[model samples]
Target chain A: MAKRTPLYEAHVAAGAKIVDFAGWDMPINYGSQIEEHHKVRKDCGMFDVSHMRAVDVTGKDAQPFLRKLFANDVGKLTIPGKALYSCMLKEDGGVIDDLIAYYFAPERYRVVVNAGTADKDLAWMRQQAASFDVTIADRPELAMIAIQGPNAREHFWTAFPAGRARTVLLQPFQAVEWDGWLVARTGYTGEDGFEITLPAAQAMAVWNKLKDAGVAPIGLGARDTLRLEAGMNLYGLDMDESQNPLESGLGWTIDLKDPKRDFIGRQALAALQPARQFVGLVLLDRGVLRSHQKVFAPQGEGETTSGSFSPTSNKSIALARLPVGVELGDTVEVEIRDKRLQAKVVKPTFARNGKAMI
Target chain B: MSIPAKLKYTATHEWAAKNAAGTITVGITDHAQEALGDIVFLELPEAGRQVKAGQECAVVESVKAASDIYAPIAGEIVEANTPAVDAPESVNKDAYGTWLFKIKPSNPSEYDGLLDAAAYEKVAAEH
Candidate 1:
């Protein structure tokens, strides 16, 4: 049986179409996914992200433990509630998972990881922390709700008025914790929003309040499209255990600033050179681009990692790992079934902040 | 759920109706549109293409995923629904009204082999 989140009842009440995703029974959409995508891009939309796991690493050795565990430097998080997006890597330089780590102090840091990789990630974290004086606590008791859009923050403030006072001035990539609520001004949709992690028992009430404040319930179907339009990578779709961050358009997330820092996968990453460039494709033809579609380019053959019809751009778009020689403005052919459809290469992002960048 | 009494349905979720022109017109069922969410694009079969029964000849893409529209029976494509192809969401709006393509059936009697409203409802329900 698939695991259900704390907001499963709320989702069912809201008439969501439920689908089993990565062992969790999650809402795919309340209705039309395109409408939900537009709602997040244009106005306020809330998502039940409770399936993601929150692991609290505490103790004197917490900072050092995370520094070696993630590809990004945890040392940069000097101020309280500063969040850093990083990729956790295996020894082979392949990505284990991408996560957001929020630092409160040297002794306490919270890392939120994807649902599908939770067990494997926890095992890896524990193995890495065996020598360090750290305590890894997987908080299954917590629930996450992400409210996003151009007008998301204001609506979130409207939903929980007292939350405004604490989180109002929080900058992008920052978080604020009070009582059981940890409101982070970070999201995967590339929009201005907050992802609130709170006590799981109180999730239904929070969802109700947010719904009452005109924050429409969005779902995974919209979430996928929204993130895709934002040029954000989906772990299983865009990159997996077999792929590295450099070829997955996540090179920026890997921190190499600290020369003294010897992290996992650093050797493999430093010694090896990447032959592929991660880029975006705008479908010039009248068909949708799906994953594993064979891409025919002048430089060499490439493959689409993630593909979708962008509601923001009103066109089919995709993220592809192509040969290094493929440049922007170059038109490539993608074979969808029998026909080779033309697509133009561009910067990996398609839209963000209620604007279509394509 | 709107399984029109006049039309026939395939287990794959496509609906077919004999038009006034005597050619069989095909479109996806309403249940299909609901399952697919929002229709984004339609890849219709060419006007002159030949197809066999249950042959996957076209595509109906939604925001979430792509689904194949199979030919109900063997026939030569007489006309592709240009307007519905141009605006695929029309099928979502009215699946029975927005036909995908028209096929001149190789055996017109093959249309009788298709499931009727009562039978299609069972198939739709099983999904």
Candidate 2:
């Protein structure tokens, strides 16, 4: 049997179509995926992201432990409540998972990981922390809600007016904790938003208040399209344990500045030459792009990692791992069925903040 | 959600409505459109083409995935809906009103062998 989040019944009451996602019964869409996708781009929409796992690592050894664990250095997060996006890798530079690390202090930090990989992440972290004097605890009692879009913050303030003063001055990637809730100015939609984590028991009440205040409930269908259009990567579909970040358009997140810092995957990444370049594709012909589609270019053969129709661009866009010589504006072809359709290479991001980039 | 009694349905989810001109108008059922979710592109059957029953002649790609539309009976294509192909979302809005193509049946008696609305409803429920 699939596990259900605290807001599952609320989604059912709103007539959402539920599907199993990472062993959790999650809403795919309320009615129309396109309509829901537009809602987030134009106004604001709420998503029940409670299925993802939050973990806390706290002790004198916490900071050093994280510095050794992630590809991105936690040492850069000096300010309290500042977050860094990074990938945890295996010893051979394979991606174990990508997560956001929130630095509350040198001794206290929190990390949120993808739902399907939560168990493995915890086990890995715990095993690695065996020699360190740190406590690794999973926050299963918390429920996460992401309110995203151009007008997300205003709608969020309108829902819980008391939070206005505390979060109004928050910058992107910053967070604040109050009333037993952690409110972060971070989101996956490439929009202005807050992902709030509060007590699971209070989730239904919080969801209801947001609904009454005009925050529409979105689902996984729109979530996928929005993130794809924003040029963000999905965990399992875009990369897995078999792949490394250098070939996944995530070299910026890896902190190579500290040559002495021997993170888990640093040695393997330094030894290997990246064979592929991560880039974006705009379909020159009419068709929706899907993941695992073959891409043909003059440089060599490549493949799309994740793809879909961009409602904002009114065309199909994709993130692809292509040959190193493939340049922007190069015309490539994608095999969509029995036919090869023309496409143009572009930057990975197609849209952001209510605007279409391509 | 709607299955008209006057029309016939195939287990594959295409609806065949008999026109007074002795031609069969074909569109996907409402249930099919709902399952597909936001039709984006369509490749309808071309006019003046001969197709046999269960032959895949049309392709409907939604925001979710692409699906094939098969011929309900052995027939020669009389006409294809150009306007519906241009605005594929019209199928999701009104599946019955938005016909994909019209079939000039080689043997009109083949239509009788197709499932009626009630029988089709039972088949749709299993899905």
Candidate 3:
């Protein structure tokens, strides 16, 4: 049997279709996935993302330990409650996992990793902490809830009035603690909202309160579509341990400016020359674009990493890894079964903050 | 669960009903649509195409994955439902009412050989 989240009973009560996702029995959809996608685009929707693990790193050497582990510079996070998106890599520049690290103080930091990679991430963190003076504590007792959309903040504030003061003042990519709950302005969906981490025992009550406040219960299916449209990469689908950040459209996250800071993957990344380019494609035809489909460009053949029909754009969009010679505005052919359909290369972002960015 | 007694069904979850004109209308079953979740797109065979029994003739793509809609019996495609093709979600709304294609069977006995509602329900339940 798959592991169940704290809100599993609530999901069953809402008539959700449950599926096994990364060993967790999660809701794929309540009813229409298209409607759920649009609900997040137009109104407010809440997702139970408790399956993702949050690990707390503390002690005197927390900063230095994370500095050596992450490709992105955690030393840049000077302000408390500021979060940084970084890829934790191995010694050979291969990405182990991409995570969001929130800096609370010099000795205290919290990192949230992907659900599928949680156990591996914790093991890696423990293995790396042998020489450092840091304690890595996995907080499985916490349940995470992501409330997202244009009116998401308002709905969240309505549900939990106690968090209104701090949640209202939260900046993008920032988090605040309120009454033992960590409410963050960061979200996977391209919307203004909060990813609140609270006691797992209290998850059902909060979910019910949000539902009563008119926040629609969204599932993992809509979450995938929303993140894809926002140009966010899913961990295993977009990149893995064999892939590096430079060729995975995550070059901006890597901080190589400081000469003295020698991270785990720094030497490998510095000596390597990236040969592939990651880009976005908008299908010019009627059919949908899917992952692992062959992409034929003027430069060379590549494959789509993630693809789906965007409800906001009313067209199919994809994130593809192509040859470095392929440029923007160029039309590429994607092999969809028997036909090679045409798609236009463009910027990866299709929508953000309830607005179309393409 | 809404299997029509007059219609025939395949183990692959396609339903076929004989019309007054002697041609048979084909569509995915209610159970199939429920399993598929949301129908995003449908790729139907051309009107004049010839098909063999159990041959994969059409494609139905849902949010989850793409599924092949196989031909229930040997037949020639007479008409493809353009409306259903344009709005694929109608299949989810009413699977029986939303016909995918009409076929003029080469041998009418093959259509009769298909499982009826009761037998098809048993097969669907096992799945």
Give stretches of model 1 more than 4 Å off: none
List of chain B TM-scores, one per candidate: 0.96, 0.98, 0.98
Candidate 1 lDDT for residue A120: 98
True contacts kept of 2: 0.75
Fnat of candidates, each listed: 1.00, 0.75, 0.50
Model 1: clashing residue pairs?
A: none
Residue A4 in candidate 1, Cα distance off native in Å = 0.6
Who wins the TM-score comparison? 1
Model 2: how far residue A309 lies from native, Å: 1.0
TM-score of chain B of 3: 0.98
| Per-residue alpha-carbon lDDT of candidate 1 for residues A191-276, written as tens digits (9 for 90 to 100) | 99999999999999999999999999999999998999899999998898899999999999988999999999999999878999
**Per-model TM values vs. the true structure:** 0.99, 0.98, 0.98
In lDDT terms, which candidate is top? 2
Minimal lDDT window, size 10, model 2 chain A: A235-244
Tally clashes: model 1.
0
Question: By DockQ, highest first, what's the ranking?
Answer: 1, 2, 3
In angstroms, how far off is B114's CA in candidate 3?
1.3
